[model samples]
Target: MIESCSGIYRIKNLSDNKFYIGSAKNLKLRWFDHRKLLRKNAHFNFHLQRAWNLHGESSFEFECIEFCEFEKLIEREQNYLDKYYHLNVLYNLNPTACSQAGMLHNQDTKLKISTALKGRVVTDEHRLALSISWHKSDKCKKQNEEARKKASLSKLGKKESIETRVKKSIAHTGKKQKPHTEETKRKISETKRNKKNVNLIKGDIYAEPS
Candidate 1:
């Protein structure tokens, strides 16, 4: 598979119990093109598209994938899929195999330019003239830099609110979530009651001695 934006995909055949599993970096573009080819009744048709039409989308699934660096992932996955699914078959021309097998056949014919067209070569004088015309204008540059600095300062000045801080803490705290136990609930209620009592006592103590 072309190591696109790093995604795993599979196309299954409902008619036969066969399946093809592969990965790509750009799953949407790659799959969309595959679907289009199937619509046009193209020869390099994928069985997964057939299964989607025949059995529905629920039939085909790509399982157990983690996004990672492309160079490491594609080679590792290509080998893994080959072993797990026996998908490295040369004769098979489904989506997984067709790209590999038909690559030789799809070689683009190289275009050659016979001769260069004779033209006036720009000298250092011409270069200076163009640079002076465009690069000397400092108004647009200053305006652009000022705008960029204003945006940067605006973003930097945004303080995290209490709600945002709590959310961020919850996300980054490596605590596994669990349902609250009876003991934990009791402790929480006690804490709330203590705080309420403290507030009440403070008001009474601070009141005028009448």
Candidate 2:
């Protein structure tokens, strides 16, 4: 016997000839939530919910309890729906959105993984090659070291948060920010570029001496 909360449910809306696939850690609660949404007529608020309510007929049917990890279960359910029912052809990102993430480290994690592996999987030969390559390549070694340092620092100190950064960026541009000017660009470029060299260069570098 399988518990309702431990697996996925595939629901069919008979009136519209469309299907909905989803996995819930607590399947009973999820279904109950859906029923509540329908009862309250909150359908038009979201895409799938809207479809399920407006086009759906009375007496929906569901198949219960396929066992797999949450991500794999959602994927399997979606595959079944797509192959047989052919409902959600566009923007079906249910499984993709289920991935675990440390928001602060998501980009860094992806970059580190891609930079380190570049589509190569680990095998005995690959491991040996990697051992050899790690010693041979300064760039790889540096990247590995930097990644490790960043990870360690993240553990030790309070990392700058993605949410905070987004809020700060929005605040900086709030309703009345001025556009960039040529003088502003020149000042910025001068500040970032070689100040000593620019100061030491011949008189009035911006002008061509006649």
Q: Which candidate wins on lDDT? A: 2
Give the per-residue lDDT of model 2 (tens digit) for 1-210. Answer: 225554666555666545556666666766765665555444322445555556653646555647666546545554554565434532232322232222233565456545645654455543553455445456778998999999898879576699989998988884876788999989988886777666667457666868
> In model 1, what are the clashing residue pairs, if there are any?
4-25, 5-25, 5-26, 6-25
**Ten residues in sequence with the least summed lDDT for candidate 1:** 108-117
TM-scores of the models, in the given order?
Answer: 0.31, 0.35
Candidate 2 off by > 4 Å: 1-3, 43-45, 55-59, 69-210
Q: What shift in Å separates residue 189 of candidate 2 from its native position after superposition?
A: 77
Q: List the residue pairs that clash in candidate 2.
A: none
Please write out the lDDT profile of model 1 over residues 4-25, one tens digit for every residue: 4665555554445466555555
lDDT of the structure predicted as candidate 1 = 0.52
Model 1, C-alpha of 47: deviation from truth (Å): 5.0
Give the Cα-based TM-score of candidate 1 against the true structure: 0.31
